[model samples]
Target: MTRKRVLCISYQFPPFAGTGVFRVLNFVEHLPDRGWDPVVLSVLPGHYERGTALDDGLCARVNGSARVHRTKCFQGIDAMLSLRGTFRGNATPASAGQGETAGTAPAGKGFWQGVKDAVTLAYRIPDKQVGWLPYALAEGVRICRHEKPELIYASGGPWTSFLIGLALKAHFHLPLVIDFRDPWMNNPYDELNVGFRRRVNRFLERWCLRRADAVIANTEPLRTLLADTAGSGNKCHTITNGYNETEYVGLKARASGTVPLVVTHVGNLYGKRTPDSFLQALTRLIDTGRLGVHEVAVRFIGHVDEARINNLIGSHPVSAMVTCVGVVPKNQALKMLFQSDIALLIQPDTRLQIPAKLFEYIRSQKPILAVCGEGATQELIEAHGLGVVADADDPEGMEGAILDVFRQARSAEGHVKKDYMAFEAGALTTQLAGVFDGVFQSSPQMKNG
Candidate 1:
């Protein structure tokens, strides 16, 4: 059988460690098995923003037949600042992990810093990664001319990837598929607060949606929102994030009641996803002597803002019960989750977004104590009997949920109930392949070409 070719443009790919990289990586790894050869176009590693960890293990997972082309990005403000500092003999090499660097801060202390910060924020109209577009587009066009792939697939929040796909479609007349790992204009954590900028983003989103041959949303709620906005429900489809079952193979589940009830949260907290309510609830339970501090322990194992977490914990008397493990390797993190008595799934109030971490949590077979809003995460937990769910904003509910999970742990009945076979990456990859097949067969351009 002749294999179809898919040109995938994604700014987030391995060896970058984060939830963002897994979707495309899995697609690349499994597409060939489904009769599609994936050609990936990604930004060069050095061009990535500082503090993004390089996961070599993920890089090794790419299929040998899949061709990955990494191109250089024009130096952004941080890179420029670092260059100038180097020329002046005063700069250290930038860290290789995710977060803002010192160069991204204000040019000076106090007022000057505020002014510089404002300018920088404004300059990042769509996103800070906009600087990568020119390089990505150049590489994309070059690849299209050489390989002439049947379709172009772009995944984002460098949302620049979609722009590249759009440009490639316009230039080559190839069908384009844009995947939304998160909503563009409706993003709850969008830092672009200016009314005009927000309007610009909305316009851009609509423009892209109209031109793309198909849209892939990682969640059903997101697909509905995108379809509603684009006024083309037929063009949108939902293909959620899933865990690679191979990762969990041979990993033993933690024996119950062997340790303190370890409730583990395995990602960063920001915006509405903070642990303020959870901390407050823990504090109240401790203060009221409803739950012993020594009976339960909370572990955070990723890149969370320490100051914010510290402030929340310090306000409560449950400080001794919490451990912030910073970040660890993906394998180690998975092991931590497997050993955990309960997994923490914190969701923002937005109904359109679900953290990609939930599938991994489910795969661990560890019960989830979800402090979330009314959204897919909550629905999934309730539907699957995956454990307890509570509103992130409700201290009483959160406290009750936590206490319940702790009680279940004490009784050795805290394991996750449902088998999430549908969420296995291999199966989900087949669904993605079906989407690609449908899009390819229906596209007049592909048929003609």
Candidate 2:
């Protein structure tokens, strides 16, 4: 069977390794089996902002799996900030979402810092990723012209990709599909969504949804939130972020009775997603002699605000057991997952987002210790009997939950045995291909194809 070509406009692709990148990378890697050939359009690696971690392995996988086109980005303030060493990651502080989550304005900022903040807030239209639009759009036009792809898929958080897809659809009259990894207008974590910027985001989100041939939200709650804007309920679908099965092919789980029971978190910790409460809870566990410092260890294996997180951990008694491993490559991170007894998930107040790490933790067969509030993350953990859930802010609840996991770990009962087949990347890609098929059939341009 001849696979139909699909132009995938993703702002975050490999070698840019992170939680979000895998969704696009995995889709690209698996779509071929579903009879869809993906042609990825992304920014040049040189254009990736400072602190955006790269994984050569993921890059190699994409290179082997698909035909990827890279273009130069208009790094204006982004380049300036990178040079200034003030900003980190692919987003400016003002474009507060993705890895750089939004937070309340810090007290006592210097005059120059305030000025920079004001300028960034005023300039960030749609997002900080807007700088990539002109470059991606031009390259997208070239790819669409030459490849004549059957459909277009644009993934967002850097919602700029959707604008590029919207433009390409306008130019070529092609079927366009948009994937929302996180909520835009109603993003719970985005406290900076206010005034003119929020209004602009609202307008852009609606405009894109109305134009998109099909819409994908990573969580079920997000699909419901986007359904109204999507115009038709059927057009918007839920295809949750999933784990790639191949990542676990050669990896072996740690023997059930490993000493110093490891509880690892494998993503960025920013904004409301902090470890203060968890550390406090762990401190209580240690003070009461429930969990010995040397008996259990906590490993944080991704990007974090080093100074802030260090301060939080330093003031705590559990700091002795806590190890901030920092950001490692995708393979190493997964290896740590296999080496651990319990996997930790920390999310508070976020209602719609179920981080990609959740699926990876499930795939590792580790008992999950979810420190979160009432939301999709909590719901999934409870529904699957995957592990224990403690309220994000309640230290007492967290203490009890940690003790529960510790008891289970001591008895060699720390592995999960729930059905995780639905969260596999290939199966999810099949669902995505189904979406592509629906769009192709319904599209006025492809009705006869």
Candidate whose lDDT is highest: 2
List model 1 lDDT by residue over 59-83, tens digit each. Answer: 8898595899998876466755665
Q: Candidate 2 residues 337-409, lDDT tens each?
A: 8889989998888888898789989998888888888878988888887888998667788888988877766
Candidate 2, residue 415: lDDT: 56
Per-model TM-score, in order, reads 0.87, 0.87
RMSD of each: 6.0, 7.2
Provide backbone clash counts, one per model: 4, 0
Report, for every candidate in turn, its global Cα lDDT versus the true structure.
0.81, 0.84
Off by over 4 Å in 1: 79-123, 305-317, 410-413, 446-449
